[model samples]
Target: MEANELLRKVRKIDIKTRGLSQNIFAGEYHTAFKGRGMTFSEVREYQYGDDVRDIDWNVTARHNHPYVKVYEEERELTVMLLVDVSRSRLFGAVGEEKREMIAEIAATLAYSAITNNDKIGVIFFSDKIEKFIPPKKGKKHILLIIRELLDFTPENQGTDISVALRYFTDALKKRCTTFLISDFIDTHDFTRQLQIACNRHDVIAIQVYDKRDTSLPDVGLMRMTDLETGASRWINTSSKRTRQAYSKWWYERQQSMSDTFSKCRVDHASIATDEDFAHSLMALFKNRGVR
Candidate 1:
């Protein structure tokens, strides 16, 4: 894309996603991901109803009066967005492309992290690491991330989720809340890596898809191509049996993906280009709250 066109696209995404982060996702984002732990804030005079266990003996002795220790949740945290920028993300039959949706979702998450006074970072990857924006706080940092997400093209066309997850685990030593955003069409056993990552950091999976990806309508003969492999084939979409079998296979793929995520105890949610992503996100947040 040209420089001006790229800027325009980035600005457009920023406007839409920033509004969502500010108005809709801010509260739920904060509630869904908790802070590291409580930290001592201050000490105050013990009230009659104050818990005796909370009294600070040293402070009490110094002041010759009982003082209760006060602590607050350490709200500062690091949030990482591991985004897949593979060729398949460019395929979309309705609404925006999968890559576009991923950009918006990532921007919203970044803004939400900044809103909560947390540091936000991102790793854009395909078969290999494409770019890494170190965790930082501020609107500038978030906008920089948004711009990169909108414009950063991947060097590879294939997806290797295990490589990305392994890189993330090695780079970020501290515990963080990591959002893995992708279509998850690649092959590799990430269950072990994901389980380990979850043990060290909170992991959430946001899987993006298109309705057409799950089924084909009776639109007669159609040409289909694999974006990642560049393989082309003609399919008789008009045949009912063909469409039914294709739909069944698609459903099985989705079920297998869901089952894999479940086995790893990872919180996963799906968003289709044809559906309202806001509703899906809200539902996921509400579900997380229940947990």
Candidate 2:
């Protein structure tokens, strides 16, 4: 993309996602992902209802009066976005491509994190770690992330979610709230990696897909290409049996992915290209906040 065009796209996303962060997700995000622990704020005079365990002996002795330690929730946190930038994300027949939707969602989440005074980082992966932008705060950092989301291309074409998850688990020592954004189209088994990552950090999965991915159009014979492998094949889309089999395959794949997430005890949401992702995201946030 041209520099001017890229800048325009970034500005546009910034405007839309910034509004969402301020108006819709800011409160819910803060409620869903809490800080590490409470820290001491100050000491206050002990009241009749105050817990005896909270009494500050030093302060009470110094002032010759009852005092209790006060504490407040630490609200600062580090958020990571593990994004899949594989060739399959470019396949979309019904609406916006998976890549486009992923970018928008990532930008919205980044804005939401900053609104809560949390640092945000990104791991762009495609069978390998394509890029790593360390966590940072402020609008400048978020704008840079949006720019990269819109323009960054991966060096590899295949998808290996396990590699990305393993890297994430090892790279950050402190527990972080991580969002794994992908289509979940990898053929390799990543359940073990996902389980380990979830055990170490708070991981949420967002699966963005196109309508065509679920079922094929009844347009007679069609040629399909595997974006990642550069393989091509012809299929009879008009045949009822063929269509049914394809749908079944897609459904089974989705069910398996859902099962993996459940086993890992991770929060997740799925959104289609033709659907309003805001509603799905809001549901996920509300659910997590309640928990």
Candidate 3:
């Protein structure tokens, strides 16, 4: 894309996502993702309902009164977005390409993180680590990230979730709330890495998919290319057997994906290309809050 066009799209996404982060998300994001731990704030007079363990006996003895050490949730946290920028992200038969949806979703998450006074970072992957923006705070940092999300292109075209997850655990020393956004179309098994990462940090999976990806239209023979491998083939989509097989494959794939998440205890939600992503996101946040 041209420089001017990229800037325009980035600005457009910033406006929409920033508004959602501010108005729609509001306290939901904070409530869903609590801090890693709490920090001591100050000492105050012990109240009737205060926890007895918090009583500062030294201060009580010196002042001849019961004083409790006040602590607040350490709101400062780091949010990491592990984004898949593979070839499949360009596929869509609906409102927007998967890539476009991903850019918007990443921007929204980044903006939401900033609203909670947290640091936001991103890892763009395409069978490898395409780029990594170190966690940082401020609107300027978020804008830069949005700009990169709009314009940064990857060198490879394949999908490998394991590579990305491994890099995330190795590079980021501190535990963080991480969002892994992708279509979950990987040939390699990354459940082991995902389980390991979840042990160290809170990880959420946001699977973006298109309705057409699950079925085929009866439009006779159609030529298709494997975006990741660059292989081309012709399929007789009008055949009942072909369509049935494809539909069955999709169902099994979805079930396996759900099982992987359940086995690892990872929170996840799937969003279709034409669906109302805002509602799905709100639901996911609400679910996490209740947990």
Candidate 4:
């Protein structure tokens, strides 16, 4: 993309997602992801009904009266977006490509984080870690991340969720809220690594999908090619039996993924290119409250 085009895309995303973060998601985001812990603000004279444990004996002795320490939630947080840039992310059958949707969703979350005065970062990964942007707080940093998400190309074409998880765990020693965004089409045993990562950091799986990935239409015979492997094959889409078998396989795959997420105790949500992702995200936020 040209320099002008990149700037235009970044500006467009800023306009759309910034308003969303301020108007729709600011409070939800703050409530869903809490601060690290409470920090001592100051000490004041003890009042009725104050917690006895919060009383400061040293200050009470100095003042010859009961004093209580005040504390507030340490609101600063780091949000990491682990995005998959494999070839499969390039597939989409509707309004926007999967990659485009991923970028938009990432931008929305980044904006929300910055609005809450939290640090935001990103890790673009395929089979390997393509790029890592360190966490920082500011609109300029957020825009840089948005620009890279829109333009960065991966060096590899395969997906390896395990590698990304391991890298994230190693690099970020402190706990952070990480969003793993991907189509998750690769066959890899990431359960162990994902479980470990979740133990150390708060992780959420955002699975992006297309309608065609789950079902096929009876549009007669069609040629299909695997995006990750560049393999081509012909399928008789007109045959009812073929469509049924394909649909069954797709459903089973989805079920297996869901089971894995359940076993790992990770929160998972699915968004399709043709659906309203904002509504789905809001539902997910509300559901998290129940937990």
Q: Which model scores highest in TM-score?
A: 2
lDDT per residue for candidate 1 within 261-291, as digits (tens), equals 8888888899987776778888888788777
Better of 2 and 4 by lDDT: 2
Which candidate, 1 or 4, would have the higher lDDT against the true structure?
Answer: 4
Per-candidate local distance difference test = 0.89, 0.94, 0.93, 0.92
Candidate 2 positional error at 225, Å: 0.6
State the lDDT of candidate 2 residue by residue for 1-291, as single tens digits: 999999899999899999988999888888888999999999999999989999999999999999999999999999999999999999878888999899999999999999999999999999999999999999899999999999998999999999999999999989999999999999999999998998879999999999899998899899999999999999999899999999999999999999999999989999998888889989999998897
On TM-score, who's better, 1 or 4? 4
Deviation in Å, model 1, residue 106 alpha carbon:
0.7
What is the lDDT ranking, best to worst? 2, 3, 4, 1
Alpha-carbon TM-score of each model against the true structure: 0.96, 0.98, 0.98, 0.97
lDDT of 4 by residue, 1-291 (tens): 899999999999889989888899898888888899999999999999999999999999999999999999999999999999999999988768998899889999999999999999999999899999999999889889999999998889999999999999999999999999999997888989999999999999999999889998899989999998899999999999999999999999899889989998888899998887888777777788666
Question: What is residue 199's positional error in candidate 1, in angstroms?
Answer: 1.4
Clashing pairs in 4: none
Q: Considering every candidate listed, which one attains the maximal lDDT?
A: 2
Point out where model 1 deviates above 4 Å: none
| Residue-level error in angstroms, candidate 3, position 45 | 1.7
Where model 3 places Cα greater than 4 Å from the true spot, the runs are none
